[model samples]
Target: MIHSHVPVSDLREHIGRTVSVRGWVHTLRLQRAMQFVVVRDGTGLVQVTNRRDGGPLEALIEALTPESAVRITGRVVDAAQVRLGGLELVPETVEVLNPAATPLPIDDRTGPEQRLDWRYLDVRRRPAARLLFAVQTTLEQGMREYAYAQGATEMHTPKLMGTASESGAEVFELGYFGRSAYLAQSPQFFKQMAVAAGIEKVFEIGPVFRAEPSFTSRHATEFTGVDVELAWIDGVEDVMAFEERMLAHAIAKVADLHGEAVAEHFGVRITVPTTPFPRITMAEAQEILRSAGWDPSGTKEDLDPEGERSVSAHMREATGHEFVFITHYPVGLRPFYHMRAADDPGLTLSFDLLWNGLEVTTGAQREHRYDVLLAQAAEKGLRPEPMQDYLNAFRHGCPPHGGLGMGLARVLMVLLGLGSIREATFLFRGPNRLTP
Candidate 1:
């Protein structure tokens, strides 16, 4: 009987027991009368020793190459001489299921640019790539769990739409069966439609497309956007509270599961951000920058990359926190959907969640008045006829609702201090990258 169970790690308890193992050959070293091979089975790696006694075991060693699939019958041994993890396996028989081609062009030593060019090879490095995917899974699962518990229904919106959700400049236009079609930049309209449909609280985690030609570290053409919207919200502050809790839950869950791995691989000390993340208005942020001699010309309503960096540095020095919410965006800079303040129409009730100098989330209270929304659309040089369906929802019955669209990859990138959003994304689809 082939015992198809062997722990990937070489513990002392499994020694002297026969077992069957299947994995890819990670590395191999040969001596005069013995051979040492390291095999990886997804969970972890194990060292296997074989006696070169003019048999199939010796042939297997000679034929083995990096990434070749193989299965073996082995007796676990307490290998004191082996370098890896203090244990090894003595294989009695071996079978080479698949052989890899020679001369691998990419490996762990490949540089970042080349590794991105050959991502499949880069994934084989074992620790770095594996940790990234693991962290992603943990974060997603945690978000789903927390949102569901908070009475939020999960949503799946269409990627192709007849009209854009936000401003039209960043939209990717295409032909849809002979008619003009644009990829959805965000699920803003549809999520609000769910509110109109009486699904009071809803969230969506899906892909968003943008045609902006950007070479920045945090920008991507196609990205996963984590969105949440709710009805009966007083202001943007309520939305901010919900977001902080969601982010904290996800970070805590990841830390509970893989904190050690994260520390070892990424050197990130995971801190589930406490509720009530520090908040400052756009004007306040500018004042803080000006006091620090980093005057970010007041003409621009929003922070540029350098401005974001300076403000983030200021927050770090003053508050010892990596996250800061910049609130009260200028009405001219915000989209047509944002709600203008009752006391002051010049500033909209909006906020951008910045984590370590990068804008990861944009959220605000939306205008529920049909006439005001239509006028804003027209003022922004967009026709209101195409948005009739959305405007109609506001006309009949719409509660005070607001939401945010957050870049999942951008969050991961900043949390782990990664250089590019591409590094956090699996099979990144940028303007120039589309294939495997």
Candidate 2:
């Protein structure tokens, strides 16, 4: 059965009809004869007015307070004076469902740490903060939409692993019976296993655990990883291009859906990046950074935070692009699984996609040959004896495969121009932060 009552966001649709709306009181104004109350459902806000000379709502209006939960039935009318939509609700009845407590724990000017302590209340007060998740939803949906259209199979790899997912370091070790188990650092090996299992293209969006103690804005103990694996790839360039177009499609969808609202709310300009995002080799990037007066004393194989920013700035200025892919990282910097270039064996066929001066993704063409994979593992000083199961996939027969792991929060942070990854995360899980 369809009900007559609707959300405040759709109140504009039932402008001339009498309807019921329910939400928390966003702001309440008291007058001698008439009172104005603005209420917010997660969708949007609507203004409700109660005439003190009312029929049955005067006392109820008098009892209302900020954040009061209420169900209000009223006639929707045009009020040019009202700022929101030039329309307001003239209340015929008001029911205070739950009177809010006197003092809210957090407010508009609250610090990020304190606001995190009371995230539920904090999110309720700021509609823009709510919109961040909305944008995130659209961004993820866009990726799925593109992936499904490309005939990719959606997958969920296990979060608990019998062995370390990435290199042995930065893994969360826990008890599994009398033995030990580690949290899956990334869906890296399993995603490749799926590719070897004859699933051509597979993608998963799930939690990834890292035991890093760094408390930087970008570092988190647990975070959502967007993983993608594909079989029959030409080289690392194929994987880089796949991610480039995927992210471009996602950013375009975000711009199409919530561009205007996000612009107004977050004061950010959304631009869908053009296809074939600027690409530069890691050596080229380092040289460009050096040319830009960036000193890289100890950082020879990989880019530091400042170097990444410098290279991104160079790309942005040189080509007027917001994204740049730094490819061909040294073999020492990348994992053992990354395929080494045939000509230059010292460098791996790997890439990191930088968005607006921050690294958001790392991808490479995985070595699919079983013998080479084992040799690479041995070269990296890793134990391949325990990884016989993973090796079996390649030993039997495996196609040339490649994949990338992207940080979901970091993507949203860069897209929305937010201060930090934590600001973009829903309930941030840092080294120290654990609760609501």
RMSD of each: 1.5, 2.0
Model 2, 98-213: lDDT tens digits are 99998777777889999889888887788888999999999999999888888899999899888775477899999999998999889888998899899999999999999999
- What candidate 2 gets wrong by more than 4 Å, as runs, is 1-3, 13-16, 53-56
- Tell me model 2's lDDT, rounded to 2 decimals: 0.88
Candidate 1 lDDT over residue span 1-436, tens digit each: 7676665854466777888778888888888988988888767788888878897679878888888888877888876777776778888877889987877778767787777787876786557787888899999999888899999999998899897655667898899998899999888999998998899899999999888888777888999999999899988888999898899899899989988888888888887787778999999998887787875555666788888888988997888888899999998889889998899889999999999899999999999888888887887888877888878888878888999989999998977778899899888887778777
The lowest-lDDT stretch of 10 consecutive residues in candidate 2 is 1-10
lDDT value for model 1: 0.85
How much lDDT does each candidate structure score?
0.85, 0.88
Q: What is the lDDT for 89 in model 2?
A: 93
Provide the clashing-pair count of each candidate structure.
Answer: 0, 0
Residue 307 alpha-carbon offset, candidate 2, angstroms: 0.8
